[model samples]
Target: MGRLLLVVRLARRDLRRRKAEALLLLLAILAATTTLTLGLVVRAAASDPYGTTRAVTHGPDVVAVADEPGDPIARAAGVVAASGPFPVAPAKLAAAGRESDVQVVGRDPAPTAVDQPAVTRGSWVRDGGVVVEAAFAADFGLHVGDPVTVGGRSLRVVGLAVSAAMAPYPGSSCWVKAGCASGVAPGTVLPPGLLRTPGLIWLTRADTVELAADPVYLIDLKLADPSAATAFATVHNGTAATPKPGRVAQGRPSLFLQPWPEIQADATRLARDSQILLLIGAWLLALLAVAGLSVLVGGRMADQTRRVGLLKAVGGTPGLVAAVLLAEYLVVAVVAAAAGLVIGSLTAPLLVDDTAGLIGAAHPAMTWATIGLVLAVALVVAVVATLVPALRAARVSTVRSLADAPRPPRRVGWLIAASARLPVPLLLALRLAGRRPRRVVLATASIAVTVSGIYVLLILNRFLNGNGPYDAAQVRVLRHVLLVWTVILLALAAVNAIVITWATVLDNRHSAALARALGATPGDVTTALTAAQVLPALAGAVLGIPVGFVLFAALMVITDGDGDRVPQPPPGQLAAVVLAVVVAVAGLTAVPARLARTTLP
Candidate 1:
C-alpha cells in the first residue's frame, strides 16, 4: 500500500509539471462529452416519450386520415370503436389578429372518443363552446372564461385541459409544401395550417349521422397485436380506408393507412442518424486526444527512462514499476470520465429538443441504461490510449537509460551528402530533418488524417444537397465548403511541413557545417532538405483522397423516392482532386525551402 501511494504521488507530480498536456486532454474530453450528451439525450427522447402518455393514451395501431368525409375504412372503425362518426376539416383561425391554420373537428354535442380532455370550466357543447388544446390555448392567451370566434360562429372558451391525442408525439405540426393558400377564410375556425399538411380532428357522431355524411374519410384502428402492425396494414390494404380505386380529391392523392411500427421506424431512423453524428464527433475528439497525449508521452520518455533506472537501483521489480506507471494514467482517465458524464447530462436536453422536432415526437425520459452506455464508451477510449506509454515505461533497462543523452542521435542520409553544395541554411535544414524520420512521419500522419476528414465532409455536404450538379445552389454550397476545407487543410499541412523542416535543420547544424566544408552550396542543401519533407507530404496527400471517399460513403444513408435530379460526379472533378492533392503537397514544402536558402549566410 505504501509503494502504491508513492506511485500515485509520483504520477500526480509528473502530470502537475506538464500542465500544457493536461489542458489539451481536458479540452478534448470536454468537447466530446458535450456532443455525446446532446446526441444521446435527443435520441432517447425521439424514440419514446414519457411512459405515462404511452400508457394512458393507448394510441391507435394505425391512423389513416382523409381530406374529405366518406371512406369505407373510417366508417368501419367508427362503428367498431363505438365512437361517433366525426367531421374533421382543416380551418384557418384569426383570433386577436394572430393567424395560424388549425384542424377544426366539428363535434356533435355528444362525445365518444375515450382520449378526450376532461373539461374544466365551460359546457362541453352548446353551439357556442369550443374546446381548444391546452397547449394551443396557452400559446394564444385564451382561457375557459374568454370569448372567441371561429368559422363565423361566436363561441365561449368552455374547457381547458390536456389531451393525450394532441400532445405532438409525432411532432405538433405536420409538414406543408411551399404553397397552400386556398380553402382558408379570414375568420374561419380552420384546421391549423399544420393540420392541412397531415392531421386529425373529430366532430360529434350525431353531426355525421344527421348530416348523413359518410364519415368514411379515414379512421384510427385500435388493434390487439402491436407486433402485427405490418400484417394488419397488408390485411386492410386497398379495402376501406385506402383511396377508392380511382378517387382523387382536388387533384390531390387520397389518404392511406400508416401503421404504428411504420411511424416508429421513421422516428427510430431519425434518432439513430443524429446519434451516429455524435459517434463521429466522439471519434474526432479521440484523435485530438491522441495528438495531445502523443506529445506528452513523447516529451516525457527521457524522464520515464531515468525514473526506471532509479526504481531498479532501489530493487523495484519490473511488474511493480509497470503498475506504478500505468496506474497514473488509469487515474487520469477515470477522473475525466466522471467529469464527462456530468457534463453530458447537462447538455443532452438541447439535442433531444432539436431531434424531437425532426421526428415529430416529444422529449424522452433519461434512463440508467443510456448513462451506462455513454460511460462505457468513454472508459474504453481512456484505456486504449494510455496503455502503450505505461507499458514502455515499465520495461526500460537501467544501465542504458542511465547512459542515454537527452538529445536524440544525429544521423546523415545520402540525400544530405549530395546536397552539401547547397547554401548553408539549406544544408542545415536538410540535415536536421534527415536525422528524425520517426517524428516527421508522425507529424505527417496527423496532418493527413485531419485533412482527409475535412475533405470527406465536403463531399458529403455536396451529396446531401441532392440537386443536380448543374443546380447553382447545390454547386454553390458544395464549392464553398470544399474550398474552405481544402484551404484549412493546406494551411495546417503547410505549418507541419515547415516545422518538420526547421526541426531537421536545428538537429543537423553540425552536419550542415561539415557539408559546407565539403563544398555544398546553400541552395543545393535547401532543395534536398525540402525534398525529404515533400516526399512524406506527397505520400500522405495521395492516400488521403480515397480514404476520404470511403469514410464519406460509410456515413451516408441512402433513401429512395426523393426526385432524381442530382448530377453525377464529373470525370474532370476526379482529375482535379488528384491534381489538387499533389499541388498541396508540393506547396507545403516550398515555403520552407525558400526560407532555408535565403536565410542561410
Candidate 2:
C-alpha cells in the first residue's frame, strides 16, 4: 500500500512537472480512443431513431407486394395481424418546385393495426390530399398544404409521417408491379423489378384509383415473433433481400416481400458506411498513436535516466521505480479515455443523416462494452508504449544511469568510407537512419498511412466522377465521411512526423554537436535530419500505393463485391502524392531539426 502511494505520488509529481509531455501523451491516446468510440457507437446511435420510429408507428415485420389485391400473400406460420393489400402506384411527383419518382400508396382515412405510419406533422391521408413520407418531404422541403402534382394530376400535401415498412427516400422498398429504376440503387443493378429512387406518399383510396399509372397491391404482415421476419421473407420469396447481380426473372413471378430488418439495413446504410470509414480511420490513428508514443517514450526515457538513477540512489526498488514510470502514462491514458468516451458519445448523433426519415437520435447510452473497449485501448497503448522503456530504465545500473552518457556509436569501416565520399548532410542522414532504424520505420509507417489515404481518395474521387454505383445522396454521405477521416488522419500523421523527428533530433544531438565541431555547418545538420525523415517518407509513399489498393479493394468487395467500375488513380497523380508526402515530412521535421542544431553536446 505504501509503495503504491509512493509510486502514484512520484508519477503525479512527474506529470505535474512536465505539463506539455502529459498533454502530448493525452492527445495521442485521445485521438485513437475518441475515433474508436465514434466508430463503435455511431452505428447504434444511427439505429436509435429507427427503433423509435418503429415503436411509435407500430412497424410491420414483413411487407409483401402482389399483382392482385386483397391479401394474395400465402398463409404462413407465426402470423398475428396484417395491414395493407392496399393499391400502389409508381408515379412521378412534381412538388415544391421539385420532381422525383414516388410510390403512392392507397390507405384508409383511419390508421391500421399494423405498419401504422405516425404522422409527424399535420393530418393523415384525406381525399384530394397526400401525406408524404417524412424523409421524402424533408428531401424536397415539402410542407403540409404544399401543392403537389402526382402523375400529372394535382393534389395537396396534407401530412408528413414516418414508417418502418420501408427505408427512407431513394432506397425505398415500396415497389410497383413493373418495378422501378433510379440513377443508382444499392450498387448492383437488377432492373425491371428493382425499386428505384421512390418516395413514399399516402393518398385516399379514391384519389389513388383515379391515378393514370398502372397500379399494384401491397400487404404488410405482422409476425407473432418479430425475430422470425427474415425466415418469413425468405420463405415468401425463396431468396434473401439482395438477389444475385445480373439475375433475370424468367417468367411472371410470385409476390415480392421485404422484411423490416432488410428495410432497416437500407435506412441505416449511410451510417453503416460512415461507421466503417471511422473504424478504419480509428485504426490508422491507433498506429500513429503507437508510433508517436514510442518515440516520446524513448525521448522521455533518455531525459529521465538521471532521475531513475537518483531514485535508485535513494534506495527505491526497481519494481517501485518501474511502477512509478508506467503509472504516469497510464494516468493520462485513463483520463484521456474518459474524455474520449464522453466526447464520442456526444458527437455520434451529430453524424446521423439530416433527412427526417427517422426521429433524431438522442444522446447514446454509454454501454459497458464500449467503455471497456475504449479503456482497454487506452491502457494497451500506454502499456505497449512504455513497458519496455520503463523496464530498461529500472534495470539500468545506478552508476551507468547516473553518468547519463550518450549511446556509443558503432564503428563500421566500409560504410564510413562510402559515406565519407558523399556530401556531409547526406552522409549524416544515412548514418542517422542506420543508428536508429526504428525511428525511420515509425516515420515510414506514419507517412504510409497518410499516403495510402490519399491514394484511396483519388480512386474514390474517380469513382464518384465516373459511372459509380452510388446515388447523389449516398455520394454526399461518403464525401462527408471521407472529409472527416481525411482531416483526422492528416492531423495524426502530422503529429507522428513531428514526434519522430523531434525524438531523432534529441537522440542525435551529441553526434550532431561533434559533427559541427569537426567541420559540418548547422545547416548541414538540419538538412541531414530533414533528409532522414524525407527518405523514409518517400519509401512509405511508394509502399502506400499497393497498400491503398488492397484496402480500397477490400472496401469495394464489402460495398459492391462485383463492381467493375472501380478506377485506378493515374500514375502522374500518384507521383504527385508521393512528392507531396516527402515535402510534407520535410516541412514537419524542419523546426525540430533546427532545434537539434541549437542543442549543445
Candidate 3:
C-alpha cells in the first residue's frame, strides 16, 4: 500500500506539472470513446422511440386486413383485444396544388382500445375534416385548418398525428387490396400499378364511403401474449396465396396479418444505418487517437530523460519508475473513458433521425458492456503508445539519461548518395525521416486513415445529396448521422497533423541546430520539416483510396440487395481529396516548423 501510494503521488504531480499536455492526451482518447459510445447507445435506444408511440397510442400487436368489411379474423385465438373493421380506400389526395396517393382510413371521435393515434396538433376525427399523419403533414407542409381534397372532395386538415400501426410515411407499406409499389419500400413486391409510396390520412366513415363506392377493411388486434404475435399472424394467414384484385375467397378469405415486432423493425432501420456510420467513425477516431498518443509520448520521453536519471540515481528500481510512467497515462485514460461515456449518452437523442415520426426522446441506459468496451479502448491506446517508451526510459543508463543525449543517427551510404543530388531541404527531409522510421510509419498511417475517411465521406455525401430510393425523412436521418461522422473525423485528423508535426520538430531539434550551424538557413530547416510530413501524407493518401473503396463496397452489399445499382463516385473527386489532404498536411506543419526553425534550433 505504501509503494502504491508513492507511485500515485508521482503520477499525480507529473500531471499537475504539465496540465496542458495532460488535457491534450485526454482530448485524444475522449474523441474516440465518445463516438463509440454514441454508436452503441443509439443502437440500444432506437426501439424505445417506437415504444413511445406504441404506449401512448395503445398500439396493436397484429394488424389484419381483408377485402370485405365484415369482421373476419377478430375472433382468432390469442386476441385479448381488438379495434376496427375500419373503412379504408386508396384515393388521390390534393393539397397545396400537389397530389399524392393516400390510404385514407375512417375513425370515430371515441378512442379505441388498440391503435388509437395520439394527436400531436389540433383535434381528432370530426365530420368533413381529415387528420393527416404527422410525418406526411410535415412532408407536405400541411398545417391544421389547411385545405386538402380526398378523391376530388375538399376537407379541412383537422390534426397531425402518429400511430404504432405502421411505419412513418414512406416506410408505411400498403394495406389496400389493389397493392402498391415504391422504390423506397424494400422487400415489398406486388402485382404492380397500385400506388407509389403513398402517405396516410384519417377521415370519418361517411367521408371514406363517399370516396369509394366499395372499400376494403382493416382490423387492429391486441394479443394476450404480444411476443407470440408473429406465430398468431402466421397461423391466421394460412396457405392461401394473395387474392387478385376483385377476387373473392374460396373458403376463408386471405387475411394478411402484420405483427408489431415487424413494424418496430421497419421503424428502427434508421438506427442501423446511423449505427454503421458512427461505428465506422469511432474506428477512424481510434486510429487517430493512437497516432496522437505516439506523438505526445515521444516528445515527453525526450523531455523526461533527466528525470529518469535522477530517479535511478536515488535508488529507484526500474520497475518502480516504469510503473510511475505508465500510471500517468492510465489515470488519464480512465477519466477520458468516463467523460466520453457521459457526453455520448447526453448527445444521443439529438442524433436520432426523424424525431417528429416518433413521440418521445430516446435516452438509452449505459450498459456494463458498453462501459467495459470504451474503457478497454482508451487503456489499449495509452498502453500501445507508452509501454515501450516507458520500459526503455527505465532501462537507460544513469549517465546517458542525465546528459540528455540524442540517439546517434544511422549512416546509410545509399541514402547519403541519393540525397546528395536533391535540394538542401529535400535532402534534410529524407535523412530526418530515415532517422525516425517508426514516427514516419505512424504519420503515414494517420494520414491514410484521414484520407480514407474523406474518400468514404465523398461517396456517402454524394449518395445522400442525390436523394435516391430512401424517403426524404429517412434520407434526412441518414444525413444527420453522416454529418456527425464527418465533423468528428475532420476534427481529429487536424489535431493529429498538428501533433505529428510538433513531435517531429522536437525529436529532430539537435540535428536541425547542427544543420543551421553548417550554413543552412532557417527557411531550409522549416521547408525540410514540412516536406518530411508531406511525403508520408502523399503515400498514405494513395494507399487510402483502395482501402476506402473496399470499405464502401462492403457497405453497398450490406445496405442494398442489388449493389450494382448504387452509383460510384467519380475518379476525379477521389484525386481531388488526396490533393487536398497533402496540401492540408503541409499547411498544418507550417506553424510548428517555423517555431522550431526560428527559436528551438
Give the worst 10-residue stretch by lDDT in candidate 2: 243-252
Cα lDDT of model 1 by residue, 177-291, tens digit:
1112221222334332323222222233433233223323335556555566566665655422221111121322345555665554443443544456566555555554554
Which lDDT values do the candidates have, in the order given? 0.51, 0.81, 0.83
Task: Give the per-residue lDDT digits (tens) of candidate 2, residues 1-601.
Answer: 4888888888989999989988989998998898889888887777878888888888988888877775546366777888878888777899767787788899999889988888889999988889999877876779998998998989899899988888877556646655554445355545554445567899987788777355777788888889988988887787546432222222224578778888888778777877887888788777778888888988898899999999999988899889989999999999999999998898887776655777666456789999999999999999998998899899999998899988786656676778888999999998988887777788888788788888878877776664243445667767777777788888888888888888888888888888899999989999999998889999999998899988888876776644455558778999989988888888989988888856756
Best by lDDT: 3
lDDT (10s digit) by residue, model 3, range 1-601:
5779989999999999999889989998998889999999996688888998999999999988877767658887788889988988889989888888899898888999999999999999999899999988887788999998889898999999999998776567567766665453333444453765678999998888888876778899998999998888878876323222112222234477888887887677678778888889998888888887887887897789999999889888899889989999999999999999999999887777645667987877799999999999999989998998899889998999889888788777788899998999999999988888888898899888878888788777776664544567778778887778778778878887888888888888889999989989999999999999999989999989988888888776665534454566788888888899999999998889888965563
Which of 1 and 2 is the better model by TM-score? 2
Q: What is the lDDT of residue 433 in candidate 1?
A: 52
Q: Model 2, residue 381: what's the lDDT? A: 91
Against the true structure, candidate 1 reaches a TM-score of 0.61
Off-target runs (Cα >4 Å) in candidate 2 are 70-75, 95-98, 182-195, 210-214, 243-253, 314-317, 411-414, 461-478, 560-563
TM-score for all predictions? 0.61, 0.91, 0.89
- Model 3: weakest 10-residue lDDT segment is 240-249
**Error in Å for residue 125 of model 2:** 2.5
